[model samples]
Target: MRPQQGMIPWGPNTTAGGRAGTQGGEGAVELVMVNPTEQAAIPRGGNSLQSQPDGKGHFGGVHGGRFVAETLMPLILELEAAYAKAKADPAFQAELAYYLKDYVGRPSPLWFARRMTEKLGGAKIYLKREELNHTGSHKLNNVMGQILLARRMGRTRIVAETGAGQHGVATATVCALFGLKCVIYMGATDVERQKPNVFRMRLLGAEVVPVTSGAGTLKDAMNDAMRDWVANVADTYMLIGTVAGPHPYPAMVRDFQSVIGEETKAQMQAAEGRLPDVVVAAIGGGSNAMGIFYPFLDDSSVRLIGVEAAGHGLDSGKTAASIERGRPGVLHGNRTYLLQNADGQIEEAHSISAGLDYPGVGPEHSWLHDIGRAEYVGITDGEALEAFTFCTEMEGIIPALESAHAIAHTVKIAPTLPKDALIAVSLSGRGDKDIFTVAEHLGVTL
Candidate 1:
């Protein structure tokens, strides 16, 4: 029997909702009615969560489709093909691995936070130290991979959009390493707040362009970068900073950033003899969270929690909790949950951390949320600030404002769990870039 328009088939006698499925023998057939929206959270063939977005980049048949202009269609297709080819090539893999290890610094440590655990007095906490990587953030993983792909495609110039400027700095650093022209589009507001990173980009020979449109934030910068790419299609590549763009980009960026999750898995096994009970990471465009969550998708025992920036409070008009307060909409060439008004117009998102100040989230995150494969929560700016101070004082590790959001959520839940429970938080970046912002918020003269 054909299921309803919004419904799908599930295994017999199983729960009727979520992307739940069971492995079956060859030619085995069983059907139970389920809402299509809730189906396929875990892929069917072998229950592997990684087997997603078959071909067209749509996660769970709802989010993520190529919604770009005709002028960019051919280029998008070319990029999709190039990425697929490169992903399968052993030579490409070896080269990327070499650069990641020798230059970008792979296998960042997973430190057990003894003080944090003692303070919480509940779950044992582990910090995935991506902040120690070159450029001081996980952004370098995607940037390095994309820049290498750009070179393979014979592109001599690279364009990127950044919010907190970590991505811009990473892109600029790689461009300088490879002698390619680099151009970064950052929001005017971000340019002012992240002046140090802006200077670093310029020093590395990148042209930093301040985008003044649309609240002067990451969304505006992305808009400008897309325009630049459309105009300079030839000899230019757009290295999207996060996994929130058109086809291949969301998937491609996730694959590159997956290194974090992959390494964390191995490290956790070696340290604790098993997978973590929960994984936590902050979500701006959700690259870091997706990176760590992707590897654990199949591990049903591990809970994945994504913390979105709640600028003021979740109910406050000023906030960046897209998944918590958004509806599905197409933005920046992909269909995802966006903070929009009743008229379907995108709303301005506010966050103390510039990196999380975007109106939409990656489509995969939306799909995961719908399928109940992951859980997302909001951390208010005040909560994050408190966590920041606590982490610095207790652990002596100053985390980036983006990572502070995750820490805030961890702080909330750690005390409630059992002592043996383990939680791993992705310390995505260092706090050096955010000291000024923190000081200003604390009413201190820096």
Candidate 2:
């Protein structure tokens, strides 16, 4: 990686790691999918479906391509074209901006946690208050945008998958606003734990389907949603909640959720007079991280940090530290880094935070990690819980378990940094939903 003007790239010794195939296998490439019922060769015309040139030679790769069966081809193509048109339209951009500001509440504050920072004794820690957004999380940001796009494309039904039920609630809320039918697939365990969100989605007139396959978690929910899509692709639009999906979903989700970065930039300038020395966010499927990291991509002065959930610890195979334990593979419509066995069977990831128990990350995250544009770290479940407790006690802020991962890093690094150095963390959501779970973990009986 070529060193930018004043930026200090972290991770590997040298930034540049060579081309696309540098780390992967060599010689002629071929993709074949074999199943119990069918076998076919995956099209390998492109190096990667996601790796298209973005004119600037910055490598705008599309990780997932449209690989649906022939029955859904026409509908998928139509939606793709509509997205292309929306991407090129200025009016669409303005409309989204208006909604973000007036409806969803844009420009969320970059709050300097004075009490917490003083207690930590190091860096000036700031919180990007995404938890204050409508529906109580950053998930609403992408849901609103996608539901709008779905409406524009004349789709009458929306389908989505959720891990902790936050995304399902957000998607259901948007569908209610647009008067479209919404169906969300959620894991049985999550539904049991996040009953409030499940109830909220139903109250919003959306159907909440509990998936029982496999471990009955995010991956199973995703598989159920995909099966639903393959069955009802004609009238349904799948509103993916993360930046890890195939093709346009990852790119589209990132673009919609990027308001976090946009707001952080402006708020930091007004509050601190400059960019932050570090921007930290928790990465599940990488949506929140991308949202907070996108604006800082070209801001060479800012350091990007992504925190992944280390269920027990990175050394523990039970952890959800994808960047730490995963390898490049295709899952849920994209070829990215996934935590799987040698035979490609997905592993069950454990995290105290249901939202952070994902086995794979976004392709852009994988690319950014490889290119050394961002640094991915892990925080153990105990550390995250400690951070959650610390923040609540010191700052009166109860962060979601997932967001606590970022707070954990801030706690570790804040005490060591100079007073002038600033840190911004994306508080992805509120912790009201996790109170019971935390209590259970802490052995505090309600």
Find the candidate with the highest lDDT and give its number. 1
Error of 1 at 155 (Å): 0.4
- Candidate 2 least-lDDT 10 residues: 31-40
- Candidate 2 lDDT by residue in tens digits, 323-381: 77887777887667778898989899889999998899887787677667689999999
Superpose all Cα atoms of candidate 1 onto the true structure and report the RMSD in Å to 1 decimal: 7.8
Per-candidate Cα RMSD to the true structure, in Å, reads 7.8, 11.1
Error of 1 at 41 (Å): 23
lDDT of 1 by residue, 1-446 (tens): 11122331111222112223322212322211112122233434433556666567777666778999999999999998898777756677778878888897776888999999999899999999999999999999999889889999999999999999999999999999999999999999999999999999999999999999978999999999999999999889999999899988888898788878877777777677778999999999999998999878878899999999989999998999999988898899988889999888999999999999999999889878877879999999999999999999999999999999999999999999999999999999999999999999999996
Among these predicted structures, which one has the highest TM-score?
A: 1
